[model samples]
Target chain A: MARINSAAQLEKVRKDIVLKKDPNKPCIAICGGIGCLGGREDLIRAFEKEIKKQKLEGKVDVRVTGCHGFCAQGPNIVIYPEEICYTKVKPEDAQQIISETVVGKTIVDRLVYIDPNTGEKAVHQSEIPFYKKQVRNILGMNPKIDPKSIDDYLAIGGYSSLAKALLEMKPQEVLEEVKKANLRGRGGGGFPAGLKWETARNAPAELKYVICNGHEGEPGAYMDRAIFQGNPHLIIEGLIIGGYAIGAKQGFIYTRHDMPRLRENIDIALEAAREHGFIGNDILGSGFDFDIEVHLDVGIFVSGEASALMRSIEGKAPEPRPKYTRTAVKGIWERPSNLNNVETWANVPQIIGKGADWYLGIGSEGSKGTKMISLSGNIVNSGVVEVPFGTSLKEIVYDIGGGIPNGKKLKAIHFGAAMGGSLPAELIDTPLDFDVMSKLGAAIGAGGLFVMDEDTSMVEMNRFFLEFLADESCGKCVPCREGIRQMLRILTRMSMGKGKEGDIEALEELCEVGSLASLCALGKTTSSPIYSSLRYFRNEYEASIEDKGCTV
Target chain B: MSDILLTIDGKEVRAKEGMTVLNAAQSSGIFIPTLCHHEKLEPYGGCRICTVEVESRGRTNYVASCLYPVEKNLVVRTRSEKIDKIRKVLIELLLAHAPDSPQLLEMAKEYGAKSVRFGKEPSFCVLCGLCVRYCAEVKKKNAIAFVDQGPKREINFIPEIASKECWNCKECFPLCPTSYLQAAYVLTQGLVGFKNS
Candidate 1:
């Protein structure tokens, strides 16, 4: 394979790859994401052996792709052209899936997703309620391509956005388009990405840096992992474009060390991208040079914080510095740096490929793009779901989520993992907007939504979140280290049926002090769970104190 | 470099452009209490003791004076009712961990923070990272550092370095607000001997 020297050469390669492939060809895309591969290696092997046994080489394509999002019903497989969706597939079912779905074009009744409320079996991918309501702009490619193959990405018009950005538009023009799109960082804070880039570009530094926050230390969130493992080139393309836009020659992807597959996929994608000239020196012959290095988190939650992440990258303990100056202005060895979330970076290519108005027309007034949420806990169909902003929480929990399992009533929904607060079931009408959620004392966070049923105790939930926050706090600040310790102590005693008169007031006072005096977001938002729990469920605390146990 | 004029507690003061609020206040004879902050070391901002309300560019926020750089026209309130309340809570929290530290106890007394609302454990180390920073920055030894995280976070001397290098130097011992580092030094020396034997 020759390196692409110019944008025309890259476009020619994409055209050549696309012309060789037939859209109507039969292709089996098996879900190879971490969630779906739970002892399902044999399932993939079965498909390979069965295809060879049937002598269907080149006639049928068996590709192992990333997570299909409906993780509760995985290992999942989708047959292209007809778009036959199969769920909860096993090794024995692989042969039948090939014969019945791929060759015969007959849909298997049991493998299709059956709507829990309607008892309707949805054969195609678009018919199911879970996939119907989602507007999967970024995640839509996961089922269509194999992560290990660069050609699969190119055939789908992958690096065309980078080529377009480098060849057609100036750096300032690209930044202006992103600003018009109103894309916010999906990694908790939702800061405007365009503003961050403009600051880094204008900062007085000869060498600037761009970092992708893939640490994703939030307990239940796997959206970053899915995107990183499934579509590594998308992130790579976005990073290269970002480096070009910010005048940065170097970039880094700081992900968690625990996920080995995600790291391997990203490495392969980077090598392939460099070989294709989408990365490395003289990208697309536009006189732009950029490269990316992948770094792993050091098993700490606060490392996801921007300042702390920069410190970690600098070989120091991952503790956040005081934000007297924004990190974009002075960061990463005192050079200008731009750090955006994995999802925020992934949205860049779409905003560039299609115009900003096309991207803006999809979402609500303020937030103008789809958000990929990792829905887990009490829901029936737990996986990742990408919905446009302004979609109600009730619709997410019911229409797309297939409602709570075991016919149990949902009591509350916990958003933003430990840092975010919980909203009672009655407030499910709240739009999934960043501002709206923050107004209700809850945060959309990094797209982790944990549903709780009737049997779940709010008091124990509060204790669980406090324990997580206390364990993850950097111990750098007083309000975080000492304050969280005292709050946990009081909550523990209260949970153990050891009631006291002044405990509630003490907890409230501690919340105010911790929120006000803490140094970083990790310490500041630690009180959110406690404050919201007390706000909505004060009766639970009162009952625990008066009755010496939980009331519900 | 040009100096910036700012108001600290309603008194006009002039400070260097890069000077922190704590440095400006101290140079101007206005007092703001702090722990885990040393003039020679980089500001850690871990202990929120010197937090003050600052109104800058139409927005008011409480920031640690040790790390917040001085700006022209900045309005800084070093002592106030709300500031005092937050400081008392911070002192009370610190008191629970380091009840025997004379410096902490004196600060608590000065701030009228009489009682430890969350109970006490009688610990001597307040996790101020003074000894850790001193070893890394001034001594340039890098012998002792923090390990673990959250409430379980603690400091320990690197066994190899402590045995090979730190035994000859006691520079960080007197820097601890409490006498905890002195005891740690004795214990570490004994452990080194045991390991060598």
Candidate 2:
């Protein structure tokens, strides 16, 4: 494997790789994401040994790629360009992957992702509804492009957007275009992208910076981490464009240290970008010199907050500053900074390639793009889903997510991780966008969709989210520090079947104080799950309050 | 920065651009009950405990004050018996899961809570944003966020691995008034309405 040192050399190598497709040989790609890594690495090794045992080394290319996103059906394997998806593969089946599929070029009926509704085994990845609804602007190229391999990314028109940006578009135009597209920050806050960029781009400063909020501290939220694992280059390209638009030369990707594979993949992507002159000083012969450095998040939930994240990057305690001073104006050692989540940055290339109006045509009027939600919790096909914004909850839960697994009735669903609200089965028709979710007392915070079955107790659910918020709160203010303490107690007594009049009123008053006086979003919305759960399922709370026992 | 003025609970409050109705209310000494919220962390909007009746831009309904940004003509009601009742019931259920915390007991007393009206036993640790927010925002370590989602949401170290990264700093423990912080809040106010065992 010769190194493509320059852009010209990289272009030539990519062209050669694109033209040279080995029809005679079969290419096997196994999902190497975190979920699949559970004994799947051993399976990969076994597959390699089996391939070598058959003496089909050169003829067969066995590669371990990133997540295929149907996590509940992992360790997933797909063969291309045929794209035959094999689900729940074991080490013992390594021979079948090599013998039946590799040699016979046939599909393994038993291992395929069977559509639960149709009872039909999906031969190709596209046939599955999980992939059917997803546009895959970012993930579409991931299956073919090896995250660690620079040539693979280049082969699939990887840095072409960066090239186009550097050559054709100015920084301000890029910002305006993204803003025109109404691209909202995917990191919980539904702030307009253009406004954030404009604030930072025009901030009073000689030096400005851009940060990619890869610190996905939300529970069950792994969409950004998966993106970093699958298509690191796309995120890089987005960051590069963001840096150019914000007039920032230096950028940082604040990631959680828990994801070692993601960290490594990103490092490789950065190296690849730098080596090809797509990321470093004077990128692609353009005078604009933008480079990105990876900063490991201390791996705490609250650090996902922009202020805390910025503080961590500065090697200080990750405490959040008052929002009265926006981080965009003074952040990351007091420089005008623009920060966006991994998904937000990843959408830049698409917005640039296709005009904002063209991008807006994909989803609802307000949310004019696709959102990749990491759907988990009691679902049959728990995985990452990228659906148009306007897709209803029913469609997301049943159509794309394959509904609750093991024949359990859907009881509740939680959007936006722990901080986001939970909805009852009645609200299943709610649209799967930011605005619609808010109407139902929820928000699309960092794109995590979790399903709950009948077995789950709403009282227990309320306790669980509060427990999380209590642990995550920074305790900087009295209301959050004290209010959550008091609320937790009342909830504890209620769940224990201990009946006391006015307990509900007490909890409500405390919640009011916390919401009224707390300084940050953490304190404000921490009570969302309990409210939604109580509102929709008051009977559940009543059952526990009256009965004094776990119903399920 | 230019300041915007608004009235919360009839008290004049000054906030900058992008401030939420809740922030203005809190600054004006208005009390709005919330559980999943934390001052030092991000707004999750999951708990819905911070709901308040807000009249702004020609709409009046219970809004999650934490998520609703402030506006010039916004009117917020932070305290109401209806909200108080809902919060008390919600907290009673929360207490059933973590009844030992003195802090919670004391808080329950503030709301005139005597005992939980539902559930059977205390599970320890209420769903507050202290540990998760502190671990992430203050500690810069997402080693422990809410690991599972929905009814399964709980704090767990990332990868569920037993490593020094977790350190059991108990930095998160102190925030859990039921398990670590003061537990009197639960004993007093929260337990007022609870059915005696």
> What DockQ score does model 1 reach against the true complex?
0.83
What local lDDT does model 2 show for residue A4?
A: 34
lDDT of 1 by residue, A394-430 (tens): 9999999989999899999989988888899999998
Tens digits of lDDT, candidate 2, A456-493: 87777777777887778875544564566666766776
TM-score of 2: 0.76
Error of 1 at A423 (Å): 1.2
Off by over 4 Å in 1: A546-548, B163-169, B180-197
- Give me the runs in candidate 2 sitting further than 4 Å from their true place: A1-13, A20-24, A546-552, B1-197
Total backbone collisions, model 2:
157
Which of the numbered candidates is closest to the native, going by highest lDDT?
Answer: 1
In model 1, state the lDDT of residue A294: 87
Give model 2's DockQ, 2 decimals: 0.05
